[model samples]
Target: GESVGLHLPTLSVQEGDNSIINCAYSNSASDYFIWYKQESGKGPQFIIDIRSNMDKRQGQRVTVLLNKTVKHLSLQIAATQPGDSAVYFCAENESGGGADGLTFGKGTHLIIQP
Candidate 1:
């Protein structure tokens, strides 16, 4: 799985509000998914992940939902903060891609408003 990237404008949210980022993929055979957050200069960091067998998984302040029926994925951030400002990416691993098989898709730029 290779990373192919494009972006959809930007999302602006208040510092204490909630944020939901969505991603859609065309691969129906994808069996694993991950949500990553990339700050200005750092590498992509793992935020949350969900396997094809499940629909939703949650982390400290984040949640990942996967809908295989429509090949859609989303990340929900509760109580957004200034630290939440970054580019988020959704990566998919095909059925047989294994642990190292992850392909990144469209990234959403999140801007925190005052």
Candidate 2:
């Protein structure tokens, strides 16, 4: 099950299944994008990243897809597990040759069902 409120969106999946998390960014000028996963009471951990020049990228058991045209990004997790349960967020940066910092999306909570 999932819930949506003033907080982030949610996606629930059963163990052993695959999970797809989607995000929409507001910055068209952002040249870089990164996906992060955060567990309860912990900092966000980097999952993967893709540049504006690229449409897709892959990591261990994860994939990040970028659609510049629609300003959308999605993360695909190969195998759902309890450990994978967390809130996933996408960040965009327009640093443009310098580190200007990043702006993050609201995030989506990934719930793994037993």
Candidate 3:
């Protein structure tokens, strides 16, 4: 079974700005990593992904950085907006493949400043 401890589920953001959130993951051996954004009880949408082989990856206005040396990760959003306000989650493919689901890290609340 996948195990994660997320205490909060909501975030508040303004009209436009920037946001940064952090997550700590288990299973230092996980190879594949992904970040997702979920809006108001909706399904998670893929934002970016990084393999254990790499330390950083970038998207349109988003960037994800991984530190294998510390088992930590972070998401950086540029020009954050009300639309960008959402729940962000990090997941790892701890199972390698098949049958096992991706293990998720405790999500963070991203509040954008106007």
Instruction: Give the candidate number with the greatest TM-score.
Output: 1
What are the runs in model 1 whose C-alpha is more than 4 Å off?
1-7, 97-100
TM-scores for all predictions:
0.89, 0.88, 0.81
Model 3 Cα lDDT, one tens digit per residue, 18-100: 66666666666777788988877799899998988999999998998888887777777887876787779988885545237
Q: How many residue pairs clash in model 2?
A: 0
In model 2, where do residues sit more than 4 Å from their true spots? 1-8, 97-99
Task: Estimate every model's Cα lDDT from 0 to 1.
Answer: 0.85, 0.82, 0.75
lDDT of 2 at 111: 92
* Prediction 3 global C-alpha lDDT: 0.75
Give each model's clash number: 0, 0, 1
In the range 32-51, model 2's lDDT, one tens digit per residue, is 88988999999999989999
Ranking by TM-score: 1, 2, 3
TM-score, candidate number 2? 0.88
Per-residue C-alpha lDDT of model 1 across residues 1-114, encoded as one tens digit per residue: 344343464899999999999888776677888999999989999998899999999999998888888778889999999999999999888775444668888689999999
Global lDDT of model 1: 0.85
Candidate 1's TM-score: 0.89
List pairs with backbone clashes in candidate 1: none
